[model samples]
Target: MTSHSFSKFWSTDLTRDSLLSLLDTPTLKSLRLVNRAFAATTSRQLFRDVYITFRSSTFTKPARMAALERIGWNIRSVTFVINHGAEMFLPPLLDPLTGEEVCFVFTPCVRTTTPTSSPTAPASGSTSTAAGERQGVYGTWEMTDLLVKQYPPLFHAAMNVSSFVAALTHMPALRHLKVSCAGQESTHRYRRSVVDYALSSLRIAIEQAPLPRLEALSLTPIHPGGIQYLCPMAGIGSLPNSCRRWTQIRRLEIHMDTFPFDKGQATDHLKLLHSYLQAFRALRDFKFRWVGDGHKGPSPLSLATEPALCELASRSQACPKTRHYLRPLKFPYLQYMVLGNAVLDASQVSDFLTEHRHSLLEFDFEQVSLRSGTWDDALAPWRTLSSAEYDAAWGEKQPAEVEVMEVPFVLGPSPEESPATSSPEQYSKRRKKKKKKRHARTTEVAVNNDLFASTAAMLLEEEPVHRGSLNFRTLREGLSNWARSKGMFWGHGHGHGHGSSHDYLHKAVQSPILV
Candidate 1:
């Protein structure tokens, strides 16, 4: 077909959305070869969110970037991810139940930077092209200078900090910037310390850049097969200088999987948090997630999994008290705050709420505990929830919220790794003892639930009274009256709920804890 005729035919053949949908990376390259119109359309789509990975062998980045700069204004976000690995860094296989490393495989490091040392070669078994490219990039004066200035020992480490800053300075429309340091240490060429240095250098570079349009920032680490050890609070304390320039930033999230849970580290975190809240005056939403549980499992090895940290156990170990108190800080524009797996005391929580109550619309307390001095003190916050106010506020359009707070009232014994005696007779006896203990715990849970229900019925009365005048029947009648008044049915587990002993005991066991 003639060029003009072909252009006209393709343009009329597919709609914009349909045309764009058909253009994956390989397909886009194929389409670009077809005609000028196809090339223009494909180029626009490909350059929308420019991605640059320094170590990938798939394509030459400098060449690709030169192509994108011609249409750089079309780009909205720039993502820079550095991959590094150290010779001694081994991936861990975790225990299913406890999340601890069950075994580890140690292997000799492979030299990836040197082309001749690479495992794969070209179809013709030639090495000149690959070696030339590697040497050209690494041997460049600019690249060597960058490596020496930022990360000296880790030459293969992706030191794109200065490049990122330079890139950010040029891109006027870029609003989102994500820089991640993950799996950066490779087998043969690795520097464990350089990872932090690289990350810190990246932050410093960002500080030097002026990005007024930048709105969202995510600085995270990605570790393959295992959990990442996040940068310390001291390293994060450097952000105020960088973030001060980010006035338009409305959303800020930082994930530190390796934050220590000791009292001293907790103090440091609180200090950092205060500084952040004070710094981001225009921030509308803030989220801080520390201590990532590896493999999303109930990691007994994690300090976050300890009963003392989250109040997970009914009987908790006494923690060394800290006399230090959190000073009040305000976030006038912050609408939402999420502090995942973070433990704060009642006073600290109250202070946070009071400071941000004007603009704070939502908060998440996932794995969060508000440690109170006493049970009554803990319940004091909910004591003033007026039924009249609730009735008025909840309507057809806005529904009242019902939360089922799960409190662990009974904790089973921790599983033993192995029996002390290896004898078959002793092992058999141990197994039997363990089974009996498990059954006993189940029975104990049932008894505890029944006791709690009877206590709630007596104590949680509509008309408050002293212990002498406590009445369960009156409380039941009051609950029934309120249910009828609300035009809601209260189920006594007659038809829908099984009335068998197994089900009854289950209800009696689950009610106090689950409800």
Candidate 2:
């Protein structure tokens, strides 16, 4: 039998797991060439992740589009990467007084003249230029309008949107859609306009068709209005009715690229947030972050400063701006709440936590400035719940006590840090000397280890830990030895990975080293 025939038979007989074990892309692509049987088995994996990049040279070409069109059915995830310069024309807003198009920005006029004896000369009626002109005689805005309207297929505009949507609609099995536009567009005033346009297109496309399997979405919007555009409100920007179709989405992450700069007043922003959050009913994990510019960590509260935060935190009463909007929020299905770089009113936040305490498993607030020393006060509602109340609601007994033991263990420098030397003998001596030092420290800490192990073993037999600390290094080392000497105790603790907190706590009570 030929090698191809043998491989074909082998591929057909292999289990799904076996086929998936072949990790390299080239190998998977080659398997499709082996035979129809191999092709059938491998095609799903080959086209699972589809990436469409929008660039000046490649966006117009139909090769990538054709491939995507053919195999879009196999796509499970699709990512759209738009280039920096791809921008849409923002038609001049009409002036109320003159009722004429008035330029919002100061843009210089650019005139063009046809060259003599050029084969690609302007048409008889035409004033000037090629289709892909970087700058038109009128200006960048005019150039953008020309490209988007005249040669829509060649530019990242409505045509691109329609094509992308068509491709997405073709994939019935798609679960993830990510639209990323990095860097500012030179022609456009708002760098986020490209992202806004892309999302708007997707929203329109989604309204027309059904994406039953889509459950996760990720995108970065530079403007606050872009979010409003993506999920349009019903009446007076109250409820986002357009996002009703996205109820199937369980995970939504919005990256606000220029948050502090673009953000509105705290109340106005929070009102917008309340409207947006109400749109997703079945969402489990929601993350909204403002990726600061140039700062290493989270952006400083530029708009929502410390004093304002303190004022908000000082009172349990919700902000007047968002009081009505946030009063109704009780995300029963939410499991993870990760918010960063944005300030939320303390009272509203407390109310949210109290309402969702039973459902929320993990809550993270990174660089979220609040009134100084008010974090505990903000989370007080959750802590104030009685043990009986917790058990009644969650069907799990809360830990009655907490033990904190600090076991000191020396964290010496790594033994592998040998000094640089010209002589091999010198290098060998340095290594030996480091090993001797480590051994001495280890020997000296032998008594400390015994003390650590005994404490851990004793704590294992006690009631569930409410809140406590032990030297992590000592606990890790001592626990292993203690487990061997005394049978492993199932420590009553949170986040034991059994999925349900009830199940985890139940098992903790039922089983004896409680981690």
Candidate 3:
């Protein structure tokens, strides 16, 4: 067929399934640019999943805004990197796609630099720069400042430090919000003063406006020290009143670097965790990681589980209306649970798995040591059958009439060697020479014995019983003949063989055979 004719025929003959398959191929991208008809059809397929690469030097804020604006309102998902200023980038991306449910990923730029300082360098004069700092100044953007300056309402409405969250207040279709800060400095900046300021500002802004539709919030703060600051107990007291607006939040993940539970200020931390659970009654999944030094502390969930502190856990049982919080803990709704060096007693882990095992699909335990008896108690219920029963159920088929045999050999000093009393030096030299000869002879005898025993066992186990056919006398004579041919001892009980058969068996068992 002619090229034009083939093209026309293929296009007309393509089914919906075939068209989708064709579009998935790498060649389709080039094919789409061939003609307007191909372009129009392929544009829909290409734009269905919107992916923006922020690392490209060509991709500026305005260009990104224009590209997103041009994609129309049909874009469903977006994956983008925010090297330095996610605050500036996220608002516009979110602003144009308010009607559609979107997923926003913020990945920090990877640092690429070699260390130049020695470990012994003086603290004051150390010239080494942090990995994040080595990425240049423009590579870092304060998330709180970026939000405050750009998207104030979404920031305020979502209880995020960034003002950019304001952009989502009116976005009823907003479903997923993921924010991650990179490195310790960024985390410190976010938690120390930025997060508090942002939240405080957001509270004020939300009081002016509210987000009734936002559902899922995932915040990963990389600063270990920032978690205590972000999830402060005192802050929890104020959040109960101010956070009444986020009634729709169902999934929350607060990833931190350090959760200082031993700082004697954990009462507020406990209260804040409880308050979040209380505020979001619709919540189904909650995860928290203790990033601080893992010293055992008062359970954050203890207070929340308490009837006095958390009125939610107390009043209802089925689909309880009260707050349900899992602090470095697992829950029934948890389809995926990652217990990272959590200080949970064996019973707690057992209880959690028992309640959630039916629904739990993925479980990860990192640096999570189980207490004694925990494993047996947790897994014993799963092992219903004994080893024999289990083998009968699932064991592979075995061939009939398998033979097994046992044989023993003994090693003794050479007949030529004489026992004698001598000087210390003479005795030492003689002992050394005897030790080497003994080792060599023992190894040779052990190897020969194993081969003979294994051959006998196999023959006995596999051969059918012939009337009066199997005889030890004939077997011994044949072995002696074979040993003579192979340059091994063949005489009647040479060396250690002069001892009892039981003694020979002991030597055979004790001798070390090198493979």
Candidate 4:
């Protein structure tokens, strides 16, 4: 194919999807080399999702600012990593006509460096010069302050993330919003106040913002505390009246390093979960990850299956709410349910499935052990029980019971002969007679050894039968014949045979049975 044809085919068929997979660095460089059409396509892919790490200085200050200016306007999702009390500066809105507002925003960070200390100071004469050098150290800080003061609106507006979210309220296309900090654990300790403030402000913004198309909301913690505080904030009592009005959210993911496992903690966690369920009638997907010290494992609170489920049933029965509100509140819309170290017994599992079996697509039970007989039988029993509960609650008839069958094992005769009437001497005589018969057969075979002319013929006669009952002589003859066919002899020093009947029978019986 011609290069032009190849390029066109690649761009149209392959590159469109492939470009989305490119990382930030490669995508940016590719845009410069490509034409307008290619650049536009690649730019959308590059700016579709933006991730900012607060801990990394490279991504935090200058590099991140440049990236935001280049693509932040078109970004559908933004995840922040706030750390070290360093605030992120917002990029100035691009002016299509002038393009003069595009200026870099420089934010200074503290860095400590130590120069080699002189053994002898140059007396008081050099103290002033040293003091001047120290003063120069504060130059960057002053410059940052001056810039903040000069552009109060830009700096202040950016500092209050609520306003930024408010601006995004009219963005009908916006779908996902994620806020996080820098260090996974340490950030929680140092930036807890900042995160709490940001979340509180965002909550207000979300309440007031015109988000008619929002779908997913994720609160991922850069520090451990972010997750720790999120659940409480979403609890029934803790959530603001306005916050509970978000009825359009469908997916929520809360990732934290610690979750309260005690009864008090569990109560708070459940309350938070209940509040979310009550508020977001459209929620379908839920995920929460709890991280804690290895020494201190998960919480030990047991969920009350009967009372809790009974309450839900009562509410559903009494409420005459519309299908739109009811549908979201119903367990049937739950597509994915994941319980990590949560006390979910068999009854709870059955109750949950009973309530929403039709909507449940994926269910995961981690670090939770069920009762021994909980699922020992077919899963149908559990399903039936759940169905029964639903039917009873709705005043319907119960299903018929299922019959299960059990099979018994059969035993054969023992190796010992029955001695109801026979004496010991009679049994000994019977054994001797059998031995004599076997000896007679061996002597007859030796006498007729010369009947066959060829060695192969002799070997064939010596070969033992593989089926039915056989004695020691038969096994010995079989082995002898097999060795001779391979140019070997029974009396040769190369091969030695152990003569243990018990061992031979054990080996034969232990071999695999191929049907």
Candidate 5:
């Protein structure tokens, strides 16, 4: 076996497709171990796209990164599955009449940073070496400055932001990056504040690191257990004022989980998310997904049963009102968009598409519910779909909100402490500081960087969603008179999407506001 054996084998012993098929069985593992040349040849095919859980027991990250190092350059994309916790304190949920599983775990966050049109085909059964199986592949790329993640109970975080930052160094040729946030079980070592640390570190990593080839970013929300409901799972609004706009990103995808069992309070973090999204001026493709009603059972698919983070009814308190969440969002370079599991008015969706009609080529709708107007009425801006109908508005045609954060300002300039890492004394001091005259610094329009921060409350804007009208029956009808009349073009319009921030990070971070 030799380096050139792959092409030779393809022509003689195997075809490229057959060799790739060997990847799924035990035979592939044996073939790689037969000889170094065989290993190298197989590795080029095996380690193309990498997924790391960072679930290592060894204190040093060298053991964890060793496998990634072997095929560092061989890697084209990487996914870091941060194991944050999920909620457990809510009451029970009334089962849906049907037995199908319901979930708030929208899995789109795990999508690789490749185009949905032509995604990078994965090497079947690819994986890094188990830590103890062989001598470690240490620092081949020579990243001496890679900051190691601390492992003490107080310092540990499921999100493992430190490990993620360290992992970024090895992925030089990386194009797409995904941080799929989740945790199934609770641990005493975990701290709620640690979520902020992970997000802030993420922003810093992207801003400071030289990801010259990086193009896509995707984030799923975080929902953890114990009784404290994590207001909004880590999403765009979590980034503080100091975080910078990531102009390098051309694609953006966000997967959001709705409050289980109940809608919780009246807050609109989605609007804040839309506000944050405008910073990515270079974005071309966008996708948003939501999965609600995950509280139907005890599994990860259904974590809570009562209501948001927790039930206020049991605590005897009233939920407060907040402003609307969704508005027309614009992207200068957006050519395509995909939206799912959302609630919107026909006007908002039509307005957004009309706004982007010049730059956008086409947009797809899935599992979306309209609050008012018919599909035929809402999509009228484009008049008719000539081709999958390129429209100008590459944005959301929905209404949304959640997690009322106290609207935090960056505290001076030290990166906030990881929840598990911070001591009680530090937590107490920060809590006291927050209790004091914090709003004194807040202004009518707290101009942080992009948008204003409004703490003022508004009347309840609870409009009933047309559950019947949520489906895009007409959009998928392909070529039909009714569908065409309602702006359905040629092929069924589908979507794709994929964000980071720092600075306010060196400062302390704020937990999202929950009712």
Candidate 6:
């Protein structure tokens, strides 16, 4: 018996596909050198999906970007990792009298051969113009922005949104995009300035090169839960129109720190983020997540009422002329959505689902809630019992009703095209309305909350959290009963590799369940 050559077997279509699937990036790159045929095959796959980082040694940003432009045509999926590098700091300014460093600065200063000094400068340098013939200056010079924008990946992810867009311009064929920021923390002093600049420059770059082909996008910021007050104190008009450039997008995921204020009523951030969310009208899949502790983030609050969120509702912003009116976040074509650690109004969520009932298939509330209404309100569809009172329940909607209709006698091949019969062909009127059709739809919302987070937080903080609600809603026994009571199907959190029963008892906050 004759055996087939290994080369011949390896060249088979099945074998090639298996090889590509099994091999890692390095192996594939090396295999390309085996022959010209392999080279052509591997080259396309090699760059089809790429993950690039801009972190340590970010000085090579230009070279990487250039290389991206070269291989961009082959890239369809890319993840751009932005590093919140070690604190961006500058040398402390020396006291002119003492010549000893006084304070460190985050803002960069300009260099000069012979520069004028500030009488009371933003920079820490002295006002003595005669101090040096070169490089000793103090004025209202903000060099941090210029440098940060120049190499966005080296800074915080929240600080360089457009750098992602700029990189996107290179890949006209790009489809799936993920921009994540996770690195060393920066001082609080620079966050507001850098983030403000980032937010301000968002529109110009996007309008310059809208990645029309983009279908899926994920924006994640790995910053700690604290220090979410990154928004500018002044009005930074963030509107839904900012993202209209990508309305054609199908999937979107956003991970934000929290509402703008550290502890107060700040609707501007909420409105702006809402605008960002409302912009995606054509989305089919969406996720909105807030990084919080114990899944005990508070519900929405008002200027007058004390905020359960952020521990205070005292923070306020000037009522700019561009202040936004709260509206239901509409996504008519949405299919699946996940809300992780989110704070939303019941009516907003209910109306959002009701308006697009025909399109939405799956909805999840992970380590969060549906916020259907206040705990004491009898009319609520779903409610969380909390020590703090929440917004009134979303008034009940008319019970879901089924609508029936009649279809044509001959629906035809594709329903869009049916050959026009010549005068020779005829059909009976009785057959025209014989086929009846019925249509009805249901919205599924899975609320997976940490039933015990409140109890834990009570120990660490002064406030009290609602505990019994999750026991009746999210826990397996309660959830199963809730589902069966509502005439809906329910499933436990168990899986092929699920944690032990004790884990469920101990860390209920981390689990995600569906109904």
Identify the candidate with maximal lDDT. Answer: 2
Each prediction's TM-score versus the true structure: 0.45, 0.53, 0.38, 0.46, 0.48, 0.49
- What is the Cα-based TM-score of model 1? 0.45
What lDDT tens digits, residue by residue, belong to model 3 across residues 6-108?
A: 6776577355336656556476678778898776666556655544332222122335445544553433333322223333223342323354423322221
**Stretches of candidate 5 exceeding 4 Å from the true structure:** 1-18, 56-59, 86-154, 157-163, 183-193, 221-245, 260-264, 294-328, 384-515
Q: What tens digits encode model 4's per-residue C-alpha lDDT throughout 274-339?
A: 444455556688765554554222212223332343244445545646211212235435677665
In model 2, the runs with Cα more than 4 Å from the true position are: 1-15, 18-22, 55-66, 86-156, 159-161, 185-195, 220-223, 232-241, 261-273, 294-328, 344-348, 388-515
Choose the strongest candidate by TM-score: 2
Deviating ranges (above 4 Å) for candidate 6: 1-15, 55-66, 89-167, 183-190, 193-206, 222-244, 259-267, 298-324, 343-348, 370-515
Look at candidate 5 and tell me the lDDT of residue 117. Answer: 14
What's the best-to-worst order under lDDT?
2, 1, 6, 4, 5, 3
Candidate 1 ranges beyond 4 A from true positions: 1-23, 54-65, 87-162, 182-192, 222-243, 264-277, 294-327, 373-515
- lDDT, candidate 1, 25-124, per-residue tens: 8877787678776677776666667666544321224554455457666566777665555532333434445766543211112122322212222213
TM-score result, candidate 4: 0.46
Evaluated at residue 409, the lDDT of candidate 3 is: 78
lDDT score, candidate 6: 0.48
lDDT of 2 at 421: 24
Model 3 scores what on Cα lDDT? Answer: 0.45
Give per-residue CA lDDT, model 5, range 165-243, as digits (tens).
4556667777887777664332332343344444444554555445678888776644322112221224422335323
Question: Worst lDDT window (10 residues) for model 4?
Answer: 110-119
Rank the candidate models, highest TM-score first. 2, 6, 5, 4, 1, 3
